[model samples]
Target: MTTAVAAPFRFFSLRVVRTRRLGPSLVRVTFAGADLAHFHSHGHDQSLSLFLPAQGRTEPVVPIELGDGWWQGWRELPDDVRAVMRSYTLRALRRNPDEIDIDFALHGIGPGAATPPGPASRWAARARAGDPVVLLGPAVADNRAIRFRPPEDTDLVLVWGDETAVPAATAILEALPAGTRARAWLEVPHAGDVQDVAAGPDVEITWLTGGRGALAEIRAARLPRCERPYVWIAGESGRVRELRRHFVQERGTDRRRVTFVGYWRRGLTEEQLRAAGE
Candidate 1:
């Protein structure tokens, strides 16, 4: 299945209340607003669509005012006025304060740099307190985009991801029940990108720096014996596919029990990737 399933999505205007660096390449932006009170998110790998404005613009130009056919209306807009849309995981949600936290991975200009400049990365780098943006997310708590649902009879959980998928994987780790057995492999561009993650007692996490030999590393690692293991993997498109193959073919995992998603592709912008249906 795709990374995000259909849900009743509504636009919420969120203003950045705070921003901080979580690591060498990660920035945590906290948002709050009255409209956020209607924002309900189910925590395990819950995804949201962020609409960012053009450089120098204060807010995204969302044509949601057009009608229920907002997506079509957005496409009809002039290029300069249309917002830049990107999908991100809901890192943390606090209902009492009407706030949400999202972790952005900055690439190209800092430690663990990779690309030249990206729309989301540029916006994140320049975002400050009080900056406003729009998000398309669930209006209710139970939504299909929250895709960390393991079978009720699951015995073990296996997860893998690169830096881009860290926040979602972290959320999944946090949601695992106590005494649940889980093993996670995370790949980041630099050693400093690895942050401490809190999870259940039986969770074992391995962090790989630079992601140079991550495929080989995971292939060499052995999974714990379990009758019904639910596996999740996400990251760069090529690597994600390779790891999915490792699980399905090499490890003999049932394809139906594995959930794999390609968060991004190396050499393509979100626009290009989406256009090509990657």
Candidate 2:
């Protein structure tokens, strides 16, 4: 029996042992290591920092010399640049030999904000198994954040989010009490993006598209919700925040019952939103 080790900084360094493309927009990386054996699973809304290779395979530094000025450039990067860590959620974890699965939503490919090198972005493009990486959290999400909690008893849970936010929502639904009422709205970018998401019963799942009509179409008809039901929602800040206010203020639902969180703000990166959330 391996005793649990208190992780330093609530984060652990693990190696990517396997990679499976779950969907067109999702990459599931299975992480394993003794360090991760004691990994704490707080909730589905877990936010973790993932460090990709500092350099890509094409330009990977040889001889592995760190203090020889090769790493100086990155070390001296500005705050915004230095804070390039990617924020992700834990999709699943197992403790036999200790393993966890993290889902990464691949939105797009772009050059680094301050450099054209795009080491991290490009690194993700070709990421594979057996690569060593760093994971920096299991930090408990804010209780106020939407869908982060499961009530003892309740009405149906209403969860909604785009591809980027669905991982957290789906994980929450999986942890809900059996037979709990629940409903979900998944805004997948592509039809293929809705590959294998599973949630508990009492959930009316709806998938939307960005190219279609605005969410107002959905919200307008949802003027009324079931009784004693807590609505757990997350997505773009604009949409999730709107529904949050609607349920709490407009519809007169108790604030404590509903968990509303804007996982990502529009026109902002996950890192930025996480930083601001801090």
Candidate 3:
């Protein structure tokens, strides 16, 4: 008898203007704003929420100087501590009206050792070009049967994940829809999270070694050049529920053309909504 879990989307504000290092642990933090066109993002693996202050930082166009009455005490936080935000993924979304871009995935200490910094990698390692950041979210990824619109006569695409789902697997291979033909499985944490994944049409980049899972050696050698295909996996939830039960009940495929997302749940945090028994 429970069913009220709505309201978790709200945003506008980011000024970190720049911060690079696409590999060795992913940073990329460019942003600006004219309310960033009231923020509307719907790219692959989209999810956001920044709200990072407490540093002498300033400028995603300046907005975090709260103190005297501080917006009426943050409108009284207590919808479960106003839902402790910090769930990333929106690797990119543009609108030069002001500007915006974001990408972050860092996890520290050996096993591909790189992501050192802290406090969200020292606010993305002292992001300098501009500053301010506290944008909310683009949320919406209940995975709605793979959330359509990449079906431009597609027949093959099976992107796997890790390293917190490789920035939505390189923003779904840079929005693969025009001449879509996929095959990217990155299970990184090392080998510099294997770069140069700027794809578009007929992509087939596979890099896995985040620990022996190239999706069981690409399903024991080969079989998906398309027999009518569509598969989009995301990082660890027991290896995306064992490749959605080995490609929908053992290679039968067609469970609405497959799109399994599990952003995280290896050692558990939100634990992929408690293993989907949510």
Q: Pick the candidate with the highest lDDT.
A: 1
lDDT for each residue of candidate 3 in 1-278, tens digit (9 for 90 to 100): 11112233445655766678777766678787666665565667765656555444342221223423333444354333332234577677666565666676666633445445444656675568766566655434343322434455557777777777787778778777666677777876677757776787577777775577765776785765567777777777788888878878877878787777766565445424644654
TM-score of 3: 0.32
- Give the whole-model CA lDDT for all candidates, comma-separated: 0.83, 0.61, 0.62
Tens digit of per-residue lDDT, candidate 2, span 186-227: 776566667555655565677775444335645564633566
Regions of candidate 1 where Cα sits further than 4 Å from its true position: 1-7, 112-114
- The segments of candidate 2 whose C-alpha lies over 4 angstroms from its true place after superposition are 1-9, 55-83, 109-121, 139-147, 220-225, 270-278
lDDT for position 34 in model 1: 84
Error of 1 at 107 (Å): 1.8
Alpha-carbon shift of residue 72 in model 1 (angstroms): 1.7
- Would you list the rank order by lDDT, best first? 1, 3, 2
Q: Model 2's lDDT to the true fold?
A: 0.61
The parts of candidate 3 lying over 4 Å away from their true place are: 1-11, 14-37, 45-103, 107-115, 118-120, 124-151, 161-216, 224-278
TM-score of each: 0.94, 0.75, 0.32
* Candidate 1 vs candidate 2, lDDT winner: 1
Candidate 1 residue 59 Cα shift, in angstroms, is 1.5
- For 36-93, candidate 1 gives per-residue lDDT tens digits of 7777777578888899996666778877665476788887778878888998988888
